[model samples]
Target: MAAPVITVSNKSLLHDQWQLLQPWFSYFDADGNPAVRYQLWDSGATATSGYFWTPTNAHWPANTTIDVAASDISNVWLRSGSAGGSETLWIRGFDGTDWSGWATFTFTTIPNSLPVATVEDQSLHVNQWARVSTLLSYSDANGDAATKYQFWDSGTAATSAHFWTPTNSHWAPNTTIEVSAADLANVWIQGGSTTGSETLWVRAFDGFNWGAWDTFTVASTNAKPVVAVADHSLHVNQWTRVGSWMNVSDANSDTITKYQFWDGGTAATSAYFWTPTNSHWAANTTIEVSASDIGNVWIQGGAATGTETLWVRAFDGTEWGDWDTFALTTTINTAPVATINDQSLHVNQWVKPGSWLSATDPEGDTITQYQFWDGNAAANSAYYWSSSNAHWASGIAIDVSAADLGNFWLHAGAAEGSDTMYVRAYDGTAWGNWDSFALTSTNTAPVATISNQTLNAAQWAQLVNWTAASDADGDAITKYQFWDGNAGANSAYFWTPTNSHWAAGIAIDVAAADLTSLWVQGGTAGGSDTMYLRAFDGTEWGAWHSFVVTTAV
Candidate 1:
């Protein structure tokens, strides 16, 4: 049933139901029945004591519908308590002056007649006090109830309306998606993923609840939903796979004004999302939606292991297309596609200390490559390519020529950090599985470290502890050493040094009791005395910090 546009002023009867009953005095006229008398009216109608003229009484209805006409609806009167008088009248929603036809209602039935109807301006709200006796006096021949009334929702409900519903009273797209959770992000759509070029609504969610779905149109050209989730924003990418690349538009067909996205599930509008125009995705790559088209929209990969809900629509320029269904599995934010079977810089003892990097995308996509130079530019950079011998991501190696030492770098190459590659298939389907990290040349060996040796002795014969420790060969020190100092109950280590070869190799814990060691070549003066430690490799002599024997007091 349609709700009517009827409205009532409701001003006159707002509080008029205050006094619907009045007290009365009566006696039983020798019959076994109680009598009541009311000979006066308070609207200036006076009373007389001799004659009696009163309203006829009848059995009242107990909790039933009241049938009355719309015209004479205001003529009904309701009696108050067991008193002699009644007051405070209301006529319910029947404001039309004539009680012509009939209406239905439900009311209560007391043993004696009570103040059923209050003569007022308007009808009562549902489930309010009603006059059940009024319906008894009016009806059609066939007992058919004839009245028109309605129930409505004047902007109050248990759930919020959708944005695509176009009520014009809800939030608009382009709002930031600010909701969050530890699990992967999700997006919801108003009328999520319906058939054809119809509008696809967007909102975000985890698997549990959802945010509002903002509506956006799809391309008229052949298009399908490619959904992905980010910070809080959703990305809805649409494109068709062709060869090893895709045919995509910077802007979708005439349906959406501008792409938008949400951060988490919040409807925070923004235009900062990924686009194929920024980095043309190869054909075999599965492009997820960026945070551009809808608010809080997100998509997950179907080829992987997780599942997520996403909002999206597809269009073939004019006709609505089928909604693409895929299981959503969230992944880490990947930068680009890197294709190599073996890392070029990898070293292995089994491979004679030389191994070549090998890489090949099933689609045969190539990267302008550069590798770290170990020898001189010509000695290390040329074997198959450039003027000098070089190694690519394949099973190729350069002989450790004499010209390579102290000369290596992470040099610039033919690709940038944001480049992406696609995989081609025999079935005309594009594969979006590989993204690579930016590559540059890095160093060859570890840097060096050194320390200042501090030797203390209780007597010139027995050394206490030393503090000077440093590494010239700067790969984190893996070993350490303690010379001259005895290992016993009195021995205590002084300062701590990084782990090193001397520290990591021939190093032994010292106890103060082993003071009988007598290898100090004579240290009465500030002359260089030999400690058991040998210089690192003896090739580059490490600068020594000498310790002097103090004057004996």
Candidate 2:
């Protein structure tokens, strides 16, 4: 048989206080309350059948009302017979179609007693205690039988709720946990397991039933503390100021600044002068240097334009004795070499009367001192123990320049011989006779060799080693010059490792790297234009003298 349609006055009521469906004949108690009896079946209007047991809280008067929200799903029942309660109604609802009943109940009954709030009591800790519950739970005074406990913050229940989260919420029995960090964003709840870390919490409940989640948020971050210092340098021309320092180190205080001095990218160790000790090395000090103090400052050519390095350093005092050195470069031009006259002078004639002298260095090393010496030998004089003939230019010429004449004689520092100072000339083609002149050397000059000394790859050449070349007046031979005929006077370049620029040595060594298409020249006196190289082999120094490598190779 089909269950009969039923009706009731109130559609919704206290979920705990009422129940509406009754399919069979039922009786009323002495107070006219619905009887908690049940019948097995339904026949005609007599209506029998279907039995139910009475409920524990079915005795509520008809006028009693309570909220019908999901939280109030228990605490109500009706008595059916001597067995006591039959059914529990979640709310007053029995429309004809659906007979689904409701029961707002607790698995664990609410305790007969209720917890009381004190000035301060925590629920989860030893010293502190609290009374926490969902909106669904109620005290015996509210006709309910379950009890719960948790902290209740003076702030909103939400505060108390989210605070206990990420902690003991899931344990069978609630627990207490200490808070780690304060809520920079939301409450910070710390919890962990014996194994490791547990999960975090999203929401908490304070009422008998939680309405919606009151979500907690993560906190903002804090910056880390650090200690630091700063350095600054100022560069002006040649000098560098490395120690004017100002520092802001940390949040609390500033740090002291230390400084160092460097030359050509290298630092000086000694603290000759310092405001603060250079050893300890601290801020704000100056080392002054003159722009002109930078000597021997030169840069190698061949790098890309403007890619030159400028090096600078201080020379305590002895700049000449190897001081700090630096090299600086510029797009500036090299000193110009200009020619006025035809660049040719006859024997016994001056070199162009007087043309202005001009030439510059790539980095500008001064030509303060000049020399002009005839590169020839005296009568009966050997290559060693020779005469003073270092005039920067000798009677011989490996690389002779038109400008070299002025550079050799006038610019060079050498005394005129007893006869006269002369220069052998190469006028475009063949070698001319000696360029004669008048001058007085204190004594008779030593005889010199003037002969062709250059040779072919497998050819042979001779060498001349003789006695010490003594100066009549007593002047010592500071230096001696010898050139193979391969290097001619006035040529642009001279052979190397064998040219006339060795210290006065009794024996000299020569190699083929020094052989050239041109030959050496006689001095201003004009010696033989064709002669092998010779060094004075004074037995006083050592009787060692050698000719060109061409002699052996």
Candidate 3:
């Protein structure tokens, strides 16, 4: 008889499902009356002399082909769930009196279903400790609850560092376990490798196999706080409020515990700290410091100003940050004084009067301008004018006209008189008191006379004499002129003395024909020719003097 042949559809079988096997054999005998039987055995089954057949009868016709279906060999052995191994199936055909050599086939059983696992994402503060646990619900259709788990970081490249496979014995699914602070610290350190967002990976096993990697994300920790102040400047006595003038912010949403300040002197400490009523300092808090608080910062003399530096910093409960700095300046100023040299001046005369100004500030300020006034009014009054006025003269020696001194002349009309002139100095910020001086007008025109203007036409060559001119104000006469008649009435006949003058005393030689021509023009033909003489005292003209000259042709 030929050995029975066994065949399988697949070389390997999954642990979760069953597999089919077929066995057939052919045998021939002369009588064709022998009974044939077949038996099957697995490698794990014990070896025995007795044959184990699928059916109780365990027989088939011989001398012909006989086939055994999968159902006929329903008791064929197979492995499932972690029971897999290199299994061998042995089949043999036997006649009632003869035996056939064994026929064998080999196959393997392998795990097919994968376990289920999930990792939940987390958000926590730095160095925070927690307990993590969840019912893994991990299972393999053919496997038991002996699932294993491990933690992994998404940044790790080699599996060696992440492959910390621990069984569910002490770390069983659904059992809570403490995540040490050190573990959280390590997670934080790893998270630093990828700021803001980091991912953790995990996987589970059903004793014999691992599931797909599952991932969860962790958020990075908070950042430090910052502070700043707006720039500022002020004068010596100025005051300012600090509230709502500074900006404070934190990334972790942490409140500021306190603020510290330094005045370019000692370092800041708790003793010098300012705590807000709200316990937490917010952005734009009002911080005020009075002028008295900065009185010592004011400077005097020398450079005229002083500077101070203020430094500030904030705390966010956890840490103190870097300092922000600001600068301040204090200034000073003083008034000025003025003086005039010439106390008196003459009308219609050009006089260069002396004047000077001086100023000194505790802050060393300089003088800016000098103002002059002609009345008793204040320096800045509208009645007192500025240096820019057309009539104003500015210099060490000022040449001012009496007409510009004041309106006194406009109302007094050149009557010999005296008045006060004022002047003041300025230091840009403050004006000095008005300093005053005297001004006078005294000169008047001189009077003149003709000695003898009566003369015969033939004796016209004789000299005509006039009295020397004199001035009321003691001024010397400058020149003299004469006219045929009163100069005020006959403007056309005015003339200056020529040929005979101061040599013989103020006089002139008049010829007969010139005398006859003067008489004809003056409408004094037969009677007499009247002549007039006048004198000047530089600034004024004197009244004319009259004389008579008889003309007989």
Candidate 4:
């Protein structure tokens, strides 16, 4: 039999020093016999003087030579005897009787490869903290373990911009930190004041060299908006716009697109809320969706009273933010108002100043008391009287009586002048401003004149002159009246003094008429008769004047 001829051998095996090498070969047999066995050598063309190939791997076993069937000629495995160097392998095939010429193959091993870094993107809120270990991973081609990591932060890139040292504090850019300390190495980075995004770069090191930069996008979340307001008061049953009372802002400078409002108390009702155009909405409803729609947003105060809370959340064309609170006090009560006009009355006359009182209360409260007093001034010293407080003395400012506010009298005795009185009103909660009542007294009676007159029987006589009436107040007499004092059958009578029959108590026109038919019959008994006369100025009457008429026998 002929020795098998080596036909092909693996050219070279290039791999890292830490990885195993597997070489392949092909051979031919003489006389149609299949090549069944193979041999390997470490150096120059021969297996005698040089070291023969041996397998250190337990799967193939360490041996002086290798055994393989014809079907497995290409299944040769080899390992580097030392670290990181080029080596040659000699191979030949045997056909049971003879061996083939040696064929050469080379194995090249390189130094430890650069570590490759892997990192996942991260999302963090502004001004928040996250650990670096959770996002970073690495692998080495030469079996070199990653011992540390480095980072480049965009925030402080111009200054201390790298992070490498082991620290629990925020990392500086391009500094190294132990991988073991990664759990403790926290990162706290922030974006601008308003809502926005940001990123960071990181790489791993295997104690020799840093790997390629692995990126981790630190996408900062949108910053939440803030709302502030001072406690406010509302009158019962009153409506007010809330835009001017609230201050809303966002750090990202994002346009505020929407807001949600809800009442923390019962003071906020659905019917009480209104838009700028007076449209109503439910409480806790999100409305005013536009950025410019904040003005004149209306909220009405219900009949109820007390403190109310309003919670608000705003959306800056993004996710909704945290809730902000503001207080709306609904239980503010306002004092009532009292109004009165200057009052006037005659001397010894009584009037109800309460009838002139006008009172108003913002809370719809009723006026519970009407207070009267002298204002500690000369005008307030006027004499006033009431059934309950018979007569109030001068300068008496103290409330003489709580009653009789409706039927109080202002009397300056007989004096004719003006005086001031003050009145105030009270609702259940508070007192109103004082109002003044001015009291005045005027008018005096007139005097009537008449003289005793004599007339013959059967002759016509003119009665006492009605024009002789005079007034102490310089007023002209407005009317004159007369009555007969004579009894039946002797009763003196009077005509219209214009020949027309006149009646008592009927006003007589003094400018045109006097008694012309006043006479006694010639056959009738003759005697003296009495008559009464009275006159009136515009306001009061004068005392009666007495005169007599005598008839001749």
**Index of the highest-lDDT prediction:** 4
Model 4 Cα shift for residue 157 (angstroms):
12
Q: Could you give the C-alpha RMSD of every candidate to the true structure, in order shown?
A: 26.5, 34.8, 37.9, 39.8
**Candidate 2: which stretches are off by over 4 Å?**
1-205, 208-553
What is candidate 2's lDDT per residue for 413-457, written digit by digit as tens? 133333333443332222333333433322333323333243333
Q: What is the TM-score of candidate 2?
A: 0.15
Ranking by lDDT: 4, 3, 2, 1
If scored against the real structure, what TM-score would every candidate get? 0.21, 0.15, 0.25, 0.31
Which sections of candidate 4 miss by over 4 Å?
Answer: 11-14, 17-23, 31-38, 43-76, 80-87, 108-113, 116-124, 130-148, 151-175, 180-201, 206-209, 212-553
TM-score-best of 1 and 2: 1
- The segments of candidate 1 whose C-alpha lies over 4 angstroms from its true place after superposition are 1-244, 247-465, 480-546, 550-553
lDDT of the candidates, in the order given: 0.26, 0.27, 0.44, 0.57
Model 4's TM-score against the true structure: 0.31
Q: Of the candidates shown, which would achieve the greatest TM-score relative to the real structure?
A: 4
lDDT of 4: 0.57
